[model samples]
Target: MKKAALLSIAMLGLTACSQGVQTMTDRTASPCGDKPNCVSTQDNREKYQLAPFTLTANASLDNIEEVALKLPGAKTAVKEGGYLRIECTSRIMRFVDDLELKIDGRTLVVRSESRVGYSDFGVNRKRADQLREQLKQSGLIE
Candidate 1:
């Protein structure tokens, strides 16, 4: 009983340490906050840099938004201009990760980052890739 209680408390403490959304500046999403739990086309760091995907002729902002919403634990948190911000929670721990998709010219730029912690075991990267695949499968991206 004592061990279980201690474990619960430790998990709660870790969850409480997660930070929320960081500010985005200009037309780019914020860079990773000294953490490996983030990846973005806006970031120049080799570990964080991801290529922006080109949009298909049939793709619209709504189509991309729909693809994001279909992902597990994902919800649209904000939509403005050509940017869509999504929040995804972990299945068990409920840790939140933020994903931003921006329409820059003819390409779609994506940024995914964990709300807290220095490592995410590649969850953010995998999530981004999953989203990209969904877009492609749905003919939203080429």
Candidate 2:
């Protein structure tokens, strides 16, 4: 009877382990079985990749704002103590609003939703035709 009870408990443990198992697709996205330990990209999909150009004033939000805007990476920044929304893409990333001045640090958060990726930022982009014309006139391009 003890042996049978041990086997039943083992089976229950195995079932519990598989309860929340999930599967995710990578860049190639072939069906891959994700274990229970797998972290869902959307369910746990809040992601950020931030580095400071120069963190001064003890990593307050303001100091880090501008340089991050000009660069390819800053996923988000604090402006006017409000969240500055940005969209990113491989070709270009653009600002969602004019600079807000609430930030006082150098560390920036490069974050995104599960449905959003850096490449999706291109949808909102427009080329700088004026700059292109200037460059052409300057003989920078044929």
Among these predicted structures, which one has the highest TM-score?
A: 1
Put down candidate 2 lDDT per residue, 52-118, tens digits, no spaces: 2222334444333433344343344223452343323333322221111222233222232222233
TM-score of 1: 0.80
- TM-score (all chains, Cα) for each model: 0.80, 0.25
lDDT of 1 by residue, 62-126 (tens): 88999999887999878888988888988887788888888977899899887777799999889
Off by over 4 Å in 1: 1-27
Lowest-scoring 10 consecutive residues by lDDT in candidate 2?
24-33
